[model samples]
Target chain A: MPPFDLKDRAAIAGAGASAYGRRLMRSAIDLAADAIAAALDDAGLARERLDGMIVTFGSPIGADADTLAQVLNLKLRAYNQTWAHGRFTASAIQWAALMVAGGMADYVACLASVSFSGLRRPMMGGAGNSEGAREAGGSHGEDPVFGMTSPGAGAALVARRYFERFGATSAQLAAIPVAFRKHAALNSAAIMREPFSAGDHQASRFVCEPLHLLDYCLINDGAACVIVTSAERARDLRKPPVHIAGMQPLPAGREEFIWAYPGFGVAQQSVFDYDAGAPPVYKMAGVGPRDIDALFTYDAFSILAWMALERFGFCKPGEAAGFTQDGRIELGGALPMNVNGGLLSEAHIMGWNHQVEIVRQLRGECGPRQVAGAEVIQWANAYGDSLIYHR
Target chain B: MAANQDDYAKPRPAISALNRPYWDALRRRELVLQRCGECGMRWYPAAPLCPRCWSRRIEWTPASGRGRVNSWVVFHQSYFRGFDAEIPYNVAEVELEEGPRLLTNLIGVGAGEIRAGMEVEVVFDDAAADLTLAKFRPRRGAA
Candidate 1:
C-alpha cells in the first residue's frame, strides 16, 4: 500500500503536562489522568468528546491502555499502546494523527507517564524486566560479561567514537546540558533549575567515560498528554491549533541500539540516508531545517541532542560541538533548542514534554521561555522519528 | 576452565530452544551463527530462518574469530550486584570479518587504549559453570 500523506489533516488542539520532579508519589494511572484532563480542559472539550486514547510508557510500570481507559472513564472507539522506549511519544502522535485522519476516531488523546522513582527499579539488571535486562547485558552476550550494563554505557560508546572521529571534546559536549539548564532556569516547572558553568559540568562525576552525570536525564514521576483532532475541529477549539504538518517514523531496519554497537560511520550514514530520501515528513510538509523557527529534538542524554543537531542537517557532521558552543542553541540564538529545558532539565516524560513545549511555543504562550515570533517547529527523537509542526 | 556457578550471579541470557546451538558452541570454545542456506547471509542471536530471504534452509557456521573494534564503552557504575567488583571494565562491539557484530569485552588492553577499527580476535570466558561467554582481545601486533 502507498503511504498516506498525513500533512495538515489533523492538528494538536491542546497539550498539558503534570508537575515534574523526583518521587511525586503518584501512580502512573493517576498521573496519566491528570495530564489527560488538563489537555481536555485546554482544548475546551468535554470528556465525552474523546473518542480514542494512546498510552505510551515503559511496560514494566503496568499502566496499559485498557486500565488507563477505565481510570479516565474513557469509552473510546479506538486505542493503541506503543512500547518503543524513548520514541513512544512521537510514535503515539503519529498513530493518533492517522486514527483521526482515517475516520477511525475524531478526537484522540496521546498520553505518556513514568514514575521511575516510584517503581524503585534500576534502569538495568536482573531486577528489571527480562528484555531490558537481556539487552543491558548485551543482547548478543558481550556487554554483561564486561560489566557495561546501562543505557548510559551504550550511549557513551557512541560519543567516544564521535570524539575520536570528529575531535569533539568533552568540554564542548558539556555545552548541551549547560544550555538546557539555562533554559530550565526560566521555566517554573523545571526540575533542575540551578545554573552551572562549563567548568561545573566538566567537574561533574563521570557516569560513563565521556558522559558526566549532568549528561543523563532526570528520573522523575510525571505525565504529559496532547489532544488531537481534525484541523477543522481544532480551529473551533479554545487554543490556537498546532498543525501536524508532517511526520516520519524511524527509517526501517535501524535497530534501537544502533548507537551501542554500530560505528560512528554507520550511525552517521543512517541519518544522512534518511535525509536523502526526502522523507515523507519533509516531502509532505513542504518544509526543511531552513524553514523551522525552533527545534526540539529529544535530549534523553546530552549527546543525543548533539547527534540530532548534526543528523537533522542543522549543522555539518562533527560540527554540533561548535554549533552549540556559542549560544546558538540557547533561546534568542540562531536556533533555539529545547527552549522548555528538554528532558535534561525540564522533566523526563519520555519526550512527551517536548510535544507540550512545541504546542506552547507555536501558540505563543511560553511567556519568558517563548521564542519570539515562532511559527514552525520541529521535534525528533534519536531513533529518527521526526514531526514538523506549524501554527 | 569453567568457573563455579556461584562465582557469577549477574543476569544471564535466557537461552531458548532456537538459540541453544549458538550457546552450546560457545561452551565448546567455538563461535557459530546462523547462515541462510539459500541467501548465504549470516546473522547472530540465532534465529530459525534466514532473516534476509525467509528461507527455512539454514545452517550453523563457525566464524573467523577475527574482527575490528567498531565501538566500546567502560561502565563506571555497576547496575547489577555481581558487577560491583568489576566496575570500569570495557564492553566492545567487534565487527567480525564475515559480517556480524558481537558484544564482548576487549582484554589484554586498557579501556583507555581501545579505539575504533583496531583489530581484535575472539577469546572464551567461562563466566559460569553452565555458561561460556565469547569475548575479544587485541590482535597480536595490531595497533
Candidate 2:
C-alpha cells in the first residue's frame, strides 16, 4: 500500500452550526437545512456544487440522512451513513476528503443533528446519569441475570479497576468536568456556560460512583454541517480551507474498546487487535499534543474526553487527572481543548459541534473563545457502549 | 424486580449463512467454530475467507468447550426492556481453546468473581426454542 499523503488532498472550507440550546419549534430537518445552508454560504459554494453527503446512523427524527439529502436538493453520487455517532462527523469529513481526493466526488457535505427533545425510546431517554443511561442501550444476553445493565453502573466497574490500578481519585477525575465547563463558559453557544469549580463538580449529584452529574454530557437539539472539497478547488473558493493533513482510523481492540477487561492489562490479546492501523492523528497534523493550538474534542462523556487526552499522547496514561488540573484544559494551558463547550455545554448533537469549532478555529472565525495563532486543530470520533467509548 | 421482561419481546438474532452452522450447533448444545482448511486458522462469527491468509477454504469444527476469559463487564442497567429482568449480567470476551475470541456471557458464577485470564468451561443454555446459547463459568483451579 502506498503511503498516506494528505498534502493538498482535500480541504474543509466551511462549517456551520444551528442554535445549540433548546429549540422546541424547529424539526431536525430544519436544523440540518439551516446548518447546511450556512456552511455552504460560508464556503461560498452553490448547492449544486456538492456531489457527496454523509450523515450519522443515529440521526434523530426529521434529521435523518435521507431527509437532509432531500432538503438540500443536491444530487449525490455518494451517500454514506456514519457509525461514528457524533465523533463520526469528523470521520465523515475524512471520508469525504478521501472521496474528493480519489475522484469519487468533488464536494461533500457532512452533517449530524439530533433532537432528544421529544424522544420516547429507552436508549434515547438515557438514565439521568450519562454512563448509566448509555449502558441501557442494547439487550444484555446473560449479564442481566445478575442485575448488571446500566451504563454508569457498568462504567463504575471499569472505573473501580482504573482506580485500583492507578490509585486515581474521584477528586482528580472531577477536574475534567470543571476544566471542560470552564472552557465552555467562554463559548456563547455553549449550554452550560457558567463557571464551575471542582468543589461544585464534587458537590453535584452522583450519577454513578466516581462520576458526578457534572461529569456527564447534556442532551440537546442541535445540528452542525461542514463542506469538504479538493484543496485546489477550495483554495479557489472564497473562504480559507483547512487541508486534510492526516486522517486514519484506529482499529477496534481490547485496549481501545474493553480496556476495563484486558488480559494482563495488555492490548495484544484480542484477535481483532491492530494498532498498526492507528493514524498518527497528532503527529500527522504536524503537531504534537503540546503543540496543539486548540482542541475540539468530543466531550460526549468526561471520561471519554480524558481518555482521548491519554490515547492521543497528550498526557501519560493514568495521568489525565493531573494533566487537567487547575483550568489547564480551559484556556492558556499547554493546550486549550474544546473551546465550544463540547457536548456538556454546547449540545449533544453527536460531536458535530466539535467539527464546527475545528473549522472555525482554522478559519480564525471563533470570537472570544478563539485561541491565539491557532493554526492546527485536533478532534476525534468515538463510538460504542462498554466496549469502545470514543473513536 | 423483572425490569427487562419487555425487552425479550424483541426478535432474536438472525443467523446468516456464514453463522448458521454455529447457531445450529448451539441448538444441539455444541459449540462450533470455523477453521481454515488450508491454513489452520480458527475463527468465530464464521466468515467466508480466512482472516489470516484471505483464503476461502475453511471448515466448521466443534470446539472443546474450554477457554479463558479475556475480559468481561457486569452490566447492571438494562438498555432494552427485554433485559430488565436479567439486569447486572456478565458479558465476556473469551479466548476459546481453538484460538478464537468470542463475545459471550459467563454463567454459574457471580459477576464480581469474573476476572481476566481466568480459565472457563462452556455450559449451554438450551431454554430457548430456536437456539441454545453458549455460556461459560469460571473453571475451578483455572484462575
Best by TM-score: 1
Mark the regions of model 2 whose C-alpha exceeds 4 Å error after superposition. Answer: A1-5, A21-25, A44-52, A57-66, A72-84, A98-107, A118-174, A193-216, A229-241, A249-285, A315-327, A363-368, A381-391, B1-11, B55-57, B141-143
lDDT of each: 0.78, 0.64
Best by DockQ: 1
Please give, for residues A300-327, the per-residue lDDT of candidate 2 as tens digits.
5576665566555565556766777777
Model 1 steric clash pairs: A137-A144, A142-B103
Local accuracy of candidate 1 as per-residue lDDT tens digits, A1-391: 2476678988999899887878888888878888888999999999998999888774556367788777678889999886636656777888888898789998998878887767766554334634444422342133454565566666787787678778888899888999999999999989999999999989998887778999888878898989989999999999989998888876535243434212244321222222323445677689888888889987877888767766566776677789898898899998989998988999988888889989999988999999999989998655567889999
Fnat values, one per model, are 0.51, 0.03
